[model samples]
Target: MNVSINIKWPLIILLMLPFTLAIGCLIQIKHFAPEPLILKKDEIFTLPSGTNYAGLEKLLRRQHLAKKTCWLPWLIKLEPKLAEVKAGTYRLQPGMTVRDLLNLLVSGKEAQFSIQFIEGERLKEWLTVLSRAPYMKHDLHDVTPQTLGVKLGDPADSILEGEFYPDTYLYTATTSDSAILKRARQRMKLMLLKIWEGRAEGLPYETPQELLIMASIVEKETAIKEERARVASVFINRLRAGMKLQTDPTVIYGISEDYHNSITRRDLMTPTPYNTYIINGLPPTPIAMPGQASLKAAAHPEESEYLYFVADGRGGHVFSTNLASHNQAVRKYRQGHDIRGNNE
Candidate 1:
């Protein structure tokens, strides 16, 4: 039996038309069934934190921001990266494809407002600026230095003050208040770890944690880079001799708003643990986020017996070993230049 060129091939092909159309219809439904209303640049999706994929899809579809929220899971099942979308306030531009939108979410390229923490400014000013920033999810009313320690699973008094080193930070439109605090804390922890790993021998601080605490005090005492080591040394000597640290920053740190600003001679007498004149040891916690230099100072103090330090009207302080020499140095160098006597 020989096979002939199939004269029934045309009929077989014709019979398959209905099946082909059915498959086409099924695909159309599977891929793009519900068309979404177009979105413009002015259109905004105020996405909240903790939004799961299913919750987000329904919301987007309802607002006409998505073509079919139902298909999101299936698409992610094909490409699992889609489910890893970050939560942020997303502004939609008109005519953006679903794929493009998903790519933005996966990349976490959300819109942000910038907040800069400047050097020399105290924590009060820093907190004020941060509280007014946009997209913050935390309550500023509850963001005192004392409160931060509590959030970190410590007692209210255990939190460090004024020590979050000044630096630039990036934040999303609706980042929580605690999240921002967490970032500053994380920075402090990182700097301490790095400095501790490379510390100098013969320093007084035994552990990285103690070093950080002392550095926090030194950081608040002086912003001058060259003076940091000497300032650190004074505290070290005080610690060795069983004397009060008597540092101004610590007293200022313990005081409330009225007490922190415009510190007076009497403020030092306040019966607070942070008032180093009264407290014999380190404060309950780190005073602030100490910078690398301050941390280094804590680790590598100057080899001097200087028991006295006074601001020299410049950005630095003058150090001396004895009262007569310190007074003489003060007369020669700091005369007529508005020097403030740091009560030791």
Candidate 2:
């Protein structure tokens, strides 16, 4: 009887050992699952492509992100979907648990980065900004305005300046720079067409391109929202009266690399397709990228007799109906200002 009891007790102990180990493993998993990842602040974690569960386990262990990640293999086995981790950059925040990290890796929602194209800036500036942006695929090598315009499917004669809408664009890792520019161009085309269709009547502009050119001028003239229409009116009134636009921004655009934060008398007198001081009508192309407000203002200018404007020595401009008033305003606010002899 004693021998049978002893044999039965050893068999029972052996049977319970497996269950005990399983329960202990379950307890361990539960304890570690909710523990916070070893991060003081938000961190950027990148998982390379083709990495599987084993690779992920090795990475977590090597990075020391968790105190006890030896059970990760078992965890992944229990939840087979966790093994399917997508490759991309991820922003891991503090207080996130191991389970949360696993869920994020499988969610495939990679971190988003942004690039801003500012209004009144040229296409070259936008390209520079795009080139410096992180994680972008730089496909535009030796890019020029003409080449870029062709890539955007624009007309052979189309100028790329002011073609792209100035706004913040969001992109994921490995996104091409050209892709962002394409989106901006598409947005600009749609918005410009919409605004052109609803433009005010009796305007001097013959086409949507003319309106865009005027909008770019207005964008460079004044940044104040309230003054945009007034600025646009000055140019439109000039176009109607057959007077020279005589705008400084157009001359600067003509000067291009030669402009050194200040325009010289020679620059104003120089003859270029974009030089409005010497040119009869609107410049051949837009000077800079115009925002929505400038586009709207150029489409619908305020009803006024103003034909000239000069810097008001403030963040605004002084509009005038005639040369005398404009010269007087320029003399008062901007003494020795570079005003055109015939007009302002």
Candidate 3:
């Protein structure tokens, strides 16, 4: 009986603990917790494109991000105006909660944007693309290779045309042309070095830079993707045989004062440093930003004595050892396709 009178404060405390925690959870759930996690795109994303909320949720469900979005629908219902959340480009962090992400969606917030540049694009084309970079307010069209912080020798020198590497580059829209151009040059150097490391031996090229020149030719020759290696081989064959590559693209490149797309035979015959038809060896530089595939093709050309090639016009090419076979292939493949051969 005396023992029964003893105080059970520990048990009483234990019983009240659940209630206290429950109340604390309720208070947190109601109004005491953080509003939302601040997602800084400038700091988080390295690439230009990525996921939205639902997409993020789906991805998170697969463990890309942390969980806690199970009650997302209910949480969104907590703030009906939040349900009107506008999807926007953001730099979301890892472990963002449903409620936190909801607030970010409801609030328009951006510090930067992701931008991409594909291979085979012209440098002039990049001006338009950079002009539209998010958070960037200034016009980059006027900025050239010299003004962009990247030192390419002379002031009027614009050797960066086809030198910009192909890849996903990270930059805030507020990033300067100088920074961008420097980054681009670095990327190009990195890419060239990588291609050089894997270059095939016994090729006619003296250096990787020369290989880039050949790659540009391969890129411009046939749009047929599978023909790159062979096309590169044909150019290499010409270089090795002391024969002029006679590539029209190089001629077109020469007279392209304003970056014209096509050229006439007269343009090919016209004397210029870039016209392979009128000169010998590779062009002074690359005509376009050759992709990795094109670079690889240039590094490792398909072995052949055939110094001639003509477009099949069906996303392919016909290789030939001489003009007769090349002409036959042209008639069968090219039909009315011009640029077969000058001697023919």
Candidate 4:
């Protein structure tokens, strides 16, 4: 044993070179390959708050993403600048690589969800939509609208109906219904203030709240975008002339809880705080949430002498400047006249 043969260190190093290079290449391939957490579009993956590299490796191994546990170490050592991965629910595409997944995780961009509040929807409808929205934490189901309004910093006498802006709201998985409502409420206040500042001169509205009430009525009256300004003008003219609004939407809203199918003559004659046919001024509160377009129309109505309008037997309306023309238009509508061709 003492008389050992001389062995060259270079030869030993050369013999080991190929194996080391092979391992290095395999690690590189695995690092650049598709991610271990890649899932289908409908599938979700969650990483707990304190998940570390070791935990991630085990999870990948369980998912059969790698043949061995050596690649993660190499990847991590190579990219030391990558921050610690955040903890949250994530969705990964099929083609995402390990590098891409790591980048997404470290950037702390969690999954985003959307909830929509449609224009002209009632507060009841909004609550239903919120309760049914996916991933929304519904804690306000038992809360009354008045209570919610107070929590939103509205006046003690304020009604919650139509106070929130209608639009698509973005939130995280844990966002509460109250949080979304708060944001929408603030947005609505801002929008109302801006529109109020740009309102047309000599308008009949004495306050922003009155303008909102009018806007809500306009929203419910017509689905046609071109008719909004004209509809607003008709209401404004009626207000200026001290005439009853006589709008069907307000009557329907007054009895919405018991409304079944059609409006009866008796219903129009019935008096309520919201019955424009019987009330001298705007309703006590808004009937439904109005979109920005309706709000704008209410703020700056088309200047016209039109005091009355009737459905033109189409998806629009016919405007008239006097009761006689309005009565004639009503007769035409009753007689199934095709007034669409005559309306501009």
lDDT, candidate 2, 114-170, per-residue tens = 999999999888888987998788888777776777666767766789989999999
Q: Of the candidates shown, which would achieve the greatest TM-score relative to the real structure?
A: 2
Off by over 4 Å in 2: 1-12, 153-158, 336-344
The backbone clash count of each candidate, in order, is 11, 0, 2, 0
Compared with the true structure, model 3 gives a TM-score of: 0.64
Q: Candidate 1 has what TM-score?
A: 0.62
Candidate 1 vs candidate 3: the TM-score winner is 3
- The reply for model 1, stretches above 4 Å from the true place, is 1-108, 118-126, 139-141, 155-157, 162-165, 258-263, 331-334, 338-344
Better of 1 and 2 by lDDT: 2
lDDT of 2: 0.89
lDDT per residue as tens, model 1, 1-344: 12344756777888998999878755654565234336756555566678777776787777877765676766666667777888777656776667767777777777765678765455666777877886666565756655656765667677455446567888777677557766876787777788888887776677777887888888778988988898989988878878788788778777856573578978977788778889877887776666778888998898889888877666677787777987877786655453335432
Q: What ranking emerges by lDDT with the best candidate at the front?
A: 2, 4, 1, 3
Model 4, 1-344: lDDT tens digits are: 43342356667788999999988877675655444544444444566789887787776667654445546756666666543888876666665667767787788787788889999989888888888877667888666655666656667767789889999999876788989998998999999999999999999888899999999999999989999999999999999999989898889888987777889999988888888888897888999999999999999999999999998877899999999999999998976754444554
Better of 3 and 4 by lDDT: 4
Q: Model 3's lDDT to the true fold?
A: 0.68
How much lDDT does each candidate structure score? 0.73, 0.89, 0.68, 0.82
Q: What is the lDDT of candidate 1?
A: 0.73
Steric clash pairs (candidate 4)? none
Candidate 4 minimal-lDDT segment of 10 residues: 33-42
Looking at model 2, report the run of 10 residues with the lowest lDDT sum. Answer: 334-343
In candidate 4, stretches whose alpha carbon ends up further than 4 angstroms from where it belongs are: 1-43, 57-74, 77-83, 144-146, 151-157, 337-344
